[model samples]
Target: MLSACFNIISVCLSLPSLSHLLCLSFSLFLAPSLSEGVSQMFGLVVSPLFPQGYPNNVLETWDIAVPPGYAIQLHLTHLDIENSENCEYDFLKVSVDGVVLSTLCGEKSFSELRSTVNPALYSTLGSMRLTFQSDFSNTERHTGFSAHYSAVDINECDDPYTGCSHDCSNYIGGFYCSCQPGYLLQEDNTTCAVNCSGEVFSSLLGSLSSPSYPGLYPENSACSYSLQVEEGFQLVLAFEGVFDIESGERGACVDSLRIRAGGREWGPYCGNVAPKDPVVTNSNHAEVLFNTDGYGANKGWKIKYTTKAKTCPDFVTVNSVLEPKRPVHQFKDQVRVTCNKGHEIVIGAKAKHHFDSWCQKNGVWSDIEICEPVDCGPPKEIDNAELKFINESSPTTYQSQIYYECEAPYYQINTDGKAQFTCEADGMWRSSDGKLDIPHCIPVCGRPSNPLESIQRIFGGKPAQLGNVPWQVFFQSPRGGGALISDRWVLTVAHMAQVDQPYIYMGFLDARNLGQGVKLEVEKMIIHPKYKRHLGDSSQYNYDNDIALVKLKGKVKMGPNVTPICLPQSEEEGQPELGKIGFISGWGRVKPRQTGKIPVSPVLLYAKIPVAKTQSCTDVKPTGPEIQKEKFVITDNMFCAGMPGVDSCQGDSGGGYAFQGEDSVFQLKGLVSWGIECGSYGFYTKVVNYLDWIRDTMAANED
Candidate 1:
């Protein structure tokens, strides 16, 4: 049983084998009445030497000491001593810092006993002392007593009895109370209270009111609120709840709410009425002051303020009508202004005519303008030319065209050889192409006129005079060709109108100088209903009704180089006699199907080919089943023109075929539709067949 007790004690103490030898040595020789103290660094085990009771009058005391921050824990594992009433004899007593905590006797055992040091007594260290006394009798003893003592660090912060109002900070032996910012610890050293005088706020949005707002404020109190926002913004303050303060007979406020901003004072508000509108500052900073007299106070005022982007006063004005006619405008907004017809904008000495104004970031408008009436002044005189106004007198105004004629020898008047000048939208006399140069009369021809001059000899045909065939219109890119039939309408092949918004170049002589030509945007396209790619089968192709009308977004101002071709008065008047020579013009390839080749001629080129009999075109044999289809036969609405080497090629599909009329003017006879190959006999859509349709369609879509 003694060996068992030694083993149990050694395991409970977690001693090493060598330490276990020392522990056994100490347990066997430990004096019951020795005066030496037991320092419990790890723990101490207590037991009498024998299983029987100790000698008579036995008195033993143990002074257990731990570190300054630690407290002792005692566990009475076994106790068999002499039993006595009220622990008068053979009693064990435990005390901490000289204060008795527990007294044991009567063979009773205890599970645990901890140090009873007050955590609030932080200046003193924790310590305990144990006393064991026995009466002068050697009879009753059963192992006497056995106990284990351990030291533990005391945690004052975890004590539920602590009364720290704000925060509790613990040290080795004890703990203390601390207060947060804007709060002061009370006399009890644990409770805290807010320091209202130190209150301050800084942010884009916040609230400020009289002290104890929404309730009666104390007498003789004053508070100030200061707010700031971003550099380019201003503060807006709004008031809510009841507002009452001391007032005088003259309506002057004694105890009041005062607002100051941008070096200016806004209010000394008092009485029951609040401000009708929110107070806005002119700058980013604002100050609110609340003052109360030593008298009665009503429900205090509650006010909220937020920052808003700064704005500039209205400084922009327009001569024309404006979309938003407000007196003030915010930054980065656009103001649109438009002028009335026949009127333009005049900013300074120069005329602007049309545009919009922008409110810049720096709070300034891009342009300030007003609309004024248009006046073109008297027409410039040309040498050997006479000005002729539609009205007898000169009624010069916007969009008015003045007619002029060159005297006899000098037949050509304007720069483009057209005897007219138009007063444009900008109140200036200009040509159709926007040229500022004044027109002058010039001699019509430098060579003598001849009756039998062969027209098809010059470079293929002849380099046409700049204004000779003004109706010719050339497609700019994705190249093709067309002829103007009206002021804003061009007639071309349906295939030539494939581009979504094709640009047409007109009113220029040399095709290389295409920039000098006026480019018009195609707004609408109408292809003939009968137009088809494959008529009878996929192999057989047809271009029979390959006609389309292109409507331009704006009207073409007519000049010598840009004029509409004259349409025939009737279908009968359009059809020329068969076998008569007719001219076809285009900016197409010179040779038939010239692969990978650009047109050699940059100028408008023409070819004169005799109209072929229908039987002659029909007699041509089909090379394959593709061309042997019945629908591929020559019909009356189509006419064959050109022979072998001299024909309209690939790029000439949308050009015009015309012959001289009795009036000596060229009238449109046909439209280049398609051909068997490039140079072989080409078929043209006979314009005489669709004259009524053309006129009716144009009239219906007129702008």
Candidate 2:
């Protein structure tokens, strides 16, 4: 195979010149291209001039491939080329299948540039390319590189990176992964798993075995085999093959085989000995489990299973009685169990009535349930109220009832007004909505008012001194009146909300004594939502929900003459019955009582007035373009509290009508809203109807 590769043409015209002029840039030998490829078992690569310098400005490459199942091995015996740090000029580049293995030049050996990632001496691809290049000039002549390459077998089996579950084979340039008998390779092409889990044998006679019964069973294996036959047939299992499993001392089952059928269990046989006799399963089904630990090395067992006539076991359970009592149940028969009369299937069950058992091929009972008595725990405690059982017999089981009562003088039962909360089916004292339904204690009022006898006067009315009606409020700017309901709030009429930069004169019966008591600045005013001021004119105002609140800038210093009026809780929303007596007081018109320019009295006057029937106010509805009845409609929120010529007058809007309860303590019952004439019967906003509103409003603006 010694064919002349190429011819080198050297001209001798300048043989006498100096070494600097002896430029041999054309003295390069280029091998065949990689596309033309060379199939070689061995090859030698050398520079164009064997013992001389390599030519400048020349590039050459060689592509060599070896036979299959072999890798290319390269050995550079001599590397005396030009020297540089990175071999940037006049270098040799070695690659395999486009993957650069190494780049070499200068006087550096291959060992100095290659770690494991880039090895120049070997290639698993069985094919390689080599390129050598030179620059346009060389300062001095130097001997070039020489390398030898050959094909060698690739021993992939010894590589740590190769993957195989049991055995691995190495051949040519490739490797393969394999598994032992009874095991199949997993999708990853490496892991091996046992192929004998949950195998079913339905024939009347059959055989069961561990994976690869004749050989050693695999470690870390868990396998099961099930056998089933006709409904009337029972299974008999006998061990036949090797029965060796991993064992420990003292009859321990390190690796075990368990046999089960018809809700019965046989030996958990382990060690070298198999069971002595064939197992008689009472039903047509048999199950066997074989397991191994991580260290087992033994040939596993095999069993022969055959069927015979079946017999069923007696079925019984706790807290229940069997129906149609049977002496001996047979295969294909069924039985039912029911809870006692007072008990139910309440635990771990979806159906509460009965549990039905079927004598199937296995003769094992199915649909078993637990039964227990129904009971509810002790009832929940109330936060601010007293709770007790409604009946004398206090069994807090299902359907028991409990009631709550709020302590008076401070608290009352809140909304929903339910009398009793019941213990329901779900073992909780709950209502239809699953809420506690226990009435919470809310603020019950009217216990803190002054209990002194009435010597007061405000309208139609005689004059009284201070402390007679202590909660009285007088507005100077709009000249209206209100009552103090809290330390920082004054309940007033909505029409007086426009009093700008306003302050109230309170705790003084005499209007002339400006400094006799508290004169507080008003911080904010809230108008009632249903005030009819937006309808048309003042005369046409409905004045239905005429209530308003004036928040004081700071908390009041409560004293003998300065205390809050407690809110009143009444039956039927505090509806004052006909002829109910209450005192009306304010700094309202008390002079001649004529319409125009009537002067408010220099003193606060109060008058005792009785609640008039609803029809009395309806009979006197104003009959003008200001059709009062049409606009007002005398809703349930308003009541007529004063009779003709003895009622609240002009400048009297927002005055308090105070009613004394059975305990002689006074509570604000209504506010003077509107009337048709001076000192005549007038309509008042019912303070009782707004209890929820007032409580919510006061809570919403709490400091």
For residue 389, give model 1's deviation from the true position in Å.
8.8
Question: Which candidate leads in lDDT?
Answer: 2
Error of 2 at 122 (Å): 99
Task: Give the per-residue lDDT of model 2 (tens digit) for 1-703.
Answer: 1111445666544555465444343544554332355667776677667557888886878776787768888777667667677888888888888887788776645564334323456888788888888888889887777776778888878877676767888876677888888777767776666876777899989887888777988875778888877887888988896788778988789989998887999878898988889998876777888877757688988898887655556654665777777776766666788866445676554438578886655555666676654456676675556877865474575567777776554455665666576666565677545676655665444443344445454335867554567777888867878888876788988877765677688877667778886888878888877775544344544677889888888866555566656667654636677887888888888753444676887778878888998777666645344444555556778888776668777677898888887777678889988776556678888999888888888789877
By summed lDDT, the worst window of 10 consecutive residues in model 1 runs over 1-10
Alpha-carbon error at 15 in model 1, in Å? 99
TM-score of 1: 0.36
State model 1's lDDT: 0.68
